[model samples]
Target: MELIRAIQLLKLNAVSTAWVDAVWDCEFTDAEPLDSTVEDEIKEDVKVFKKVYKQLLGFSKEDSTQSVWNVFGENCVSVKSLVAVLACFVLGAKAKSSSVEQRRHSLQAAAVYLLLLRIPGSVANKVFHQILFDSCLDIVLKCWPQSAGKKRKKETLKSSQGDGKSGKRPKPPKKVSEEMVIDEEDDEEEEEEVYFSAQDLLGMREDVCSLIQTLLKLLENFSLRDKPQSADSCVRLFTELTNLEPLVGELSFSEKRDVDKLQSLPELAYHGLWLLCSSSNHGEGNECRRRVFFTDCCTLFLMMRKERAKPCLLPPSQAVCNARDQAILFISQIVDEQTEATLPLLKILIQHICHQIVEKSEYRASGAQAVGRLVTKMPCQNYADFVKWLFNYSLNTRVAFRMFALDVAMVLLAQEEREADATLEPDLASYLSHRFLVRSVVYGRRSDVSPTVRAHAMHCLAQCLELPSHNATKWIHELFSSSSTAGSQTMMETGHSEQTLKRGETAQKTALTFRTIELTKHKSLAVTTRRSTDELPLAAA
Candidate 1:
């Protein structure tokens, strides 16, 4: 054991020294124009680096428990030597060197570190594993060059404006303008630090794809998921990668190689999501963890949808289609398998779907259908709580979200109508029998600003009135009649001037009046309106 440990430690030191010499040679050679002599020296150093790296790879395959303890144990150095080397490679990949080959080599080395980390019992400490995960993720994220096209376009515009004003005397005297300019320059400097050369950009697509593929393979290791922090980072990395643009217009010309590399992204992302979901099953008792897992899953689905919505120059590969279908099928299965354990997962899904609706994403229609499907599968005992929440959500100021809420409410009412029987649960029966709830739908139809919202509210009201247990027709009729009477009364009072009464004002006043009358006329309606009182203030506002 002593002999083997000494051999491993010597090999570790050699690898570190070789890597530093290689980086030093590249940095100095890049500073001056590359001459034959300098280029030969740099190549020689790179060869030495590769030779030692290979030896490290081969000899370090076995568990070096005693050696690792000697270096990282108490009364010794606390720094993680292996992880430090990995960080160096990551930094090398993002270095300011103009050599594409150098960056590629660094990326390849970092990927090797990932594989080494995958070796069973190679890294026992969870904290070191977390550090390795962060390094891998950092390389993946920092190399992508997001929004490059927009930045270049903005720069071009600035250059043109500057050239056009070259002959003019520019006057700038305001302190506020000077401060703004200083802030803008600071932002531009920050952005410029990450800007890659044209050479680097040419091969970045293949390099990034290779790194991600290796990382995905590494994810199979149990240590990455054993700790919550590392697991969360892994999840976040996958989510962000999914959101990346597969093909930037200015970056690549959509070559066959680029297309092939980009093709694997969606599929790999799907695999990552599947692994995460399956792993969450092992922790069934950990509700908070499972909730986070489900939330990330839903977010991943949304991001994939957003990616699909982007107009691509090349046709989507079969893998992309297969991955998307499989993801959808997986989400559907989760929704179908409703149980006490999965109820929290379903709630998380609902919350994310609601966020999609609020953002008015192009994928929101499908999300709305998902919401309806999820609500239908909810347990009877939780249905009332969900409905109450949905009612409050519909009162949001955003027209699109309000319309979405109305659509969901229609689905719920339809489900209740379909499921209502002699053995109906008391909570759901009480929910359906609430006249104020039905009248709120009526209020939306009459008072909402957007015609689409009003139309949806009308449909929701129709669904509500269609319920067998709901006797809201008389109330809706009185509400509409009162609204019309108020409108006419206002017009008459104001001498029939169009300016005297705006479009929705009379309807709002009439809604208030009808609410008062209904409350006064039927105290039972108010009693049945359990848990919905929270929305009244919002509605009034």
Candidate 2:
């Protein structure tokens, strides 16, 4: 069937092979008239092609094409020979498609496997990953939801399409894109790095990290993106992971090759990784998340430089767009005012994006949004200045996702900075932001921050008062002095009481706690330095 379909497709342009050129000159002996078997073979080829091609690519059958179907049987040779020819033809289609569709017709892989008996379908679904087809396949692959393999309470999608027979009839999904060459003629060639720690040649962390890096770096590579093999990197990465003891032992193997591996790796592995990453597919029948999907994603970003792709990590083709945007925003957060070491990662990631996006005025704005998201997860209040820089950058550049950045920053602001003495966690920015909720002060007096963001900060801080007065006052002196500007100034005005404070309470209870900050008519400031019944006064209008 596969051969028949391929042959029919070949007949479309008829002057030669389905590809731009003619099939390699056949060495037929002085034409002892073509046998009738040749006609059957041709019909069979057309039938198979129409079946698998339509299903996998949403491609339509071209009419009146020749095939090589009927030429088979004991007369044609053993099933093994017939199968050999079928495999070769499909592989040819796969290779030709790399240049033609740019995707390996990955979606139709189920059909290829059936042809090879790797699966139970009526026809073979094998396809080589053409970068273009893989590109769109990556998008459709993302749609599978991590749960594709899960047994839902709802009726599960039957694995079998039944009878394994496809026809001239159209499949439900009929969308089509532009086309180009075919894979058969390319017969071609082309083609993961895994470092096993001495700790465990079989340990999954390193392998997992490498796989993640492959996906990330593929997205980061930016240069190979246009060609059909763009996803080749992802495929390669996933393939390497599959070979690792952890995945192979766990997933053991699949009837279908794991396509999520990384286009840069192997087609099937890329698909598996995608299954692992999504909520739906991750938890489906296969349950990729049972091992930890989110951890996989977060760890992918947290990888030590050595663990990631050589030079740097990148995301897969589909992830290229989203990952690039994310990496851009992530880098901007740690770049200037924070840790200078992060500059290297930022530079590398920047190299992987589209040149147009990299240099556009909008990138400045994107930087701001990215920084905002980063600062929320970072370790310092001073980073708000970074947020200011970002906001100003966004203001100047007019980038998209600004609101998202501001939202992330506001979430971070509500968090109190980590202890000055406690050694902080590594690398998510350098310090904790103050948990203050005074919007007017955070946004208005702090003027550098956005008003809406400050308002959110205020809302989060206000929640603290509800903790009960004893608790609220317990930390009053520290809350003011430790991380807040108001706290620091108040400490200076009144020497702290000699009383040794206890833990787990609000600062309001302190002997000389802040009652209210009243802005005097003059621009200079007036602060109330005692805990009292009144709310803090607003800054002078």
Candidate 3:
């Protein structure tokens, strides 16, 4: 009777402060090691609240009396409020339970109630993806042995030790008895057993993965509809979940040793990435939602980028890489036209392309291709910057990356010839000098050690020769002069050398490797700048 009266009093409260606090504090029981009788009492109280909540929903529909609605509304008897309260209830139940099975069952109950019920998706999604996810993540993070902080402190201590003078080695200890040795061995084995079991991390992974899968199903159900916001919500949840830094900071991993081993963490972000991308693809119909989705994904990529900087032995999560790939592909398809809204998107894509090119990820080729497509669509000013970036890369790194950068540059520079409407930005236009073009090509074709790079450099030179700019003819003259000068120098050196046979053979090979630009008139310069595939015939058709 007192429990029912207390529930009624909370319902009657009008102020947000009064009711929110009252309901939030309405846990089943505060006592630990709850007895059967206490559990039964708490369950009874929960049942009464559930019953009243249903009645309010039912009566509010049938009884359209404004007075009744106003009274119930004051008590905040909406679906969201109800879901929040029930989530609190389930979390409290799980926390208060001593048995692992009981806690799991409590969490399952929370999932079933929030997800399996025929509640409106808006209400259910908000609670399941946001509130429940956060609560579950908190639970999982707690399950981790709190050793991140201690590990950090240990690292700092080790680092600080290097700065101070080295201390003398301690004397060797005397041998202990066989019984003491056995006792120490037993303790070491016990610690190893606990570390290997990893029950907490396993249990947390199972529960969280289950919930994430359920949320993904809910997202799919809303896909193909005009639920752009729904898609946004799904992506937003993942963006928060996959990020570990904020969670680490909040949990203070620096101070604790709860995590048994540093490497024993579950693949939390890996599972969330695919879902985020697939769901976002389904929900990008609304313009506003699409923009927000892109922005949030960029943020998520940055967060993952930060995560990579932390020292870990494991390879990157495949899911993180896949998610980034999907984001690039998505941005490429959706942002068909360059606008102010997409400037940030283009910047991030370019950044990723540059990093991927240098890092040599499996997706580097795809990232480069995406950047290639983006360059053609970029605003004139941005395109100019991209051209300069490619130029810099080609000149700086004399490696395969430089080859790829030159290939991309070939496509960009040839865009003017391929499409008459294509115009160069002032930055790129002013820098298209005969000397700059000639110098870049001459170094690549003659100086680069790799045959493949030399081939690509030749292809780029061919494309440049076909360009219709005023400097094209001048570039041709300069290339011929440089090639002649190199050939003459090689002849003089070869003639004067004692080993004339070896020197003659080397000079012959050098002559064959020189930049061969054949000017043939075609309708337009259809230069095949793709060096990622099989080798092409050298003759410029």
Best by TM-score: 1
Structural RMSD, model 1: 12.9
Task: Work out how many backbone clashes candidate 3 has.
Answer: 12
Reference-based lDDT, residue 363, model 1: 45
Please give each candidate's TM-score. Answer: 0.54, 0.29, 0.40
Instruction: Tell me how far candidate 2 lies from the true structure as C-alpha RMSD in angstroms.
Output: 22.3
Cα deviation in Å at residue 248, candidate 2?
20
Which regions of candidate 1 deviate over 4 angstroms?
1-83, 95-99, 124-129, 152-186, 190-210, 224-226, 244-263, 280-330, 334-339, 359-367, 376-385, 395-401, 410-424, 429-444, 447-541
Tens digit of per-residue lDDT, candidate 1, span 176-250: 322112112223343334556787676675666766665665555444434555555555566555445442221
Q: How close to the true structure is residue 374 of candidate 1, measured as C-alpha lDDT?
A: 65
lDDT of each: 0.47, 0.30, 0.41
What TM-score quantifies how close candidate 1 is to the native fold?
0.54
Q: List all candidate RMSDs to the true structure.
A: 12.9, 22.3, 17.5
| Clash totals in order | 0, 118, 12
Q: Using lDDT as the measure, which candidate wins?
A: 1
Per-residue accuracy of model 3 over 159-226 as CA lDDT, tens digit each:
65454345755444455333122111122222211231468556645555554544444443334235
Candidate closer to the true structure by TM-score (higher is better), 2 or 3: 3
Model 2 TM-score is: 0.29
